[model samples]
Target: MSMLEPQAPDLRVQKWIGADGESTGPLKLSDLGSGPKILFAFQHWCRGCHVHGFPTLQRLHSALSPRGVGFAVIQTVFEGADENTFEKLRVNQLEYALPVAFGHDEPLVGATLPTFMEDYRTRGTPWFSIIDAGGRIVFSDFHLDADRIVKDLELV
Candidate 1:
């Protein structure tokens, strides 16, 4: 890849917080199974995350997981530190009935934003990023078109 072509940063997230259901570890982007992977960035306190973000993610996961699409959820806590605690990761995971791995992201020592947010350059909670089969971030934004994703993955 050319230097000008940005590559997907290796995922450096907090521990994989799991409750009951099975989940993959605090893995890098390359660690995800071969095929496209979706990274759902959220915060427990964000109503938008529950009302829109997760529902969007759930549709994508339910439709594409069986088709070899990998999924991971990260609670990037740039704010609401008390409400968006590590414990809430599992709560959201179970609440959504999403069986994929969940991560908790807090600001690193001396840093204002979590590692994932800094690496991905995310704006805020309810962000979504998609890493392609070759580990390239094909899409990164706050809003998603669940139907478009489902249709697009059908082609992939």
Candidate 2:
């Protein structure tokens, strides 16, 4: 969202699915305080997300999760509500072998955009963001550069 200072965005997730594929109930960004945090925004029906975004995330998680980088996935259902249902959160987690907390940010009001997309000012799916341990927005972009992310994670 073109943040000038290092500030964490409001995590307005409607539902949550834990790493164990179980409901975690509602949660906020403050709830996750385990070192560096990486949040990946995707939609199940997005072809690019399935082909590239998720694979990149998986690799990033493989490399950083061991290094104490907390990972989370948010299904920002900006479109394709039928395809990107909350049930797919679990399915995608298992399918992608992602053992990280997953969130379902459904659209509100007249069904325009999900809370994450609107609050984070995400253009569309395949968005990625990172917050350092100090709760600063270190990285936010549509492209995922694994090496750059690893470098940024060091600041946390």
Candidate 3:
């Protein structure tokens, strides 16, 4: 899907642990409040996501989080994977401190990256969505501009 389209309004997510054993949420963009929330959907195995998307996500989180913007990430694994390769992928090494969840978790609601592509009609990784405190989506994109997100928040 092109980044310009609005995301599904009723999209729901759940909470679960990541490969690092940390608590994470299958959160909806609307649920983010008290300040703006930025959601970054990613997969551990996507090379572009790891090299470019995540680093940009980190920068956005670091700069905006303190200013009351919440950041969350979803790290997905393909449904048909063996333990060896899945175990080799690490979510903790990615440089952001946001809460994270994985597709393997029980509460995923089948919203993994592959599922999101089919369900949300998006084609790739690093899908970003910005939701306001009232739950209305303000901006959604496949590409993120770290400086732009941070700068925009300063104005809010």
TM for every model, in the order presented, reads 0.92, 0.90, 0.67
lDDT of 3 at 36: 78
**How does candidate 2 fare on TM-score?**
0.90
Off by over 4 Å in 1: 1-5, 18-25
What lDDT tens digits, residue by residue, belong to model 3 across residues 23-123? 55555544444687776666655777768887887788777877888665654444423431333324443344444343331124554444444444445
**Structure candidate 3, residue pairs in collision:** 13-26, 14-26, 15-26
Order candidates by TM-score, high to low. 1, 2, 3
Model 2 misplacement above 4 A: 1-3, 154-156
Candidate lDDT values, in order: 0.85, 0.84, 0.57
Kindly list the per-residue Cα lDDT of model 2 for residues 57-144, writing each as its tens digit: 9988998888888888999987788889989999999999999889998888786889888877789879888887777777778897
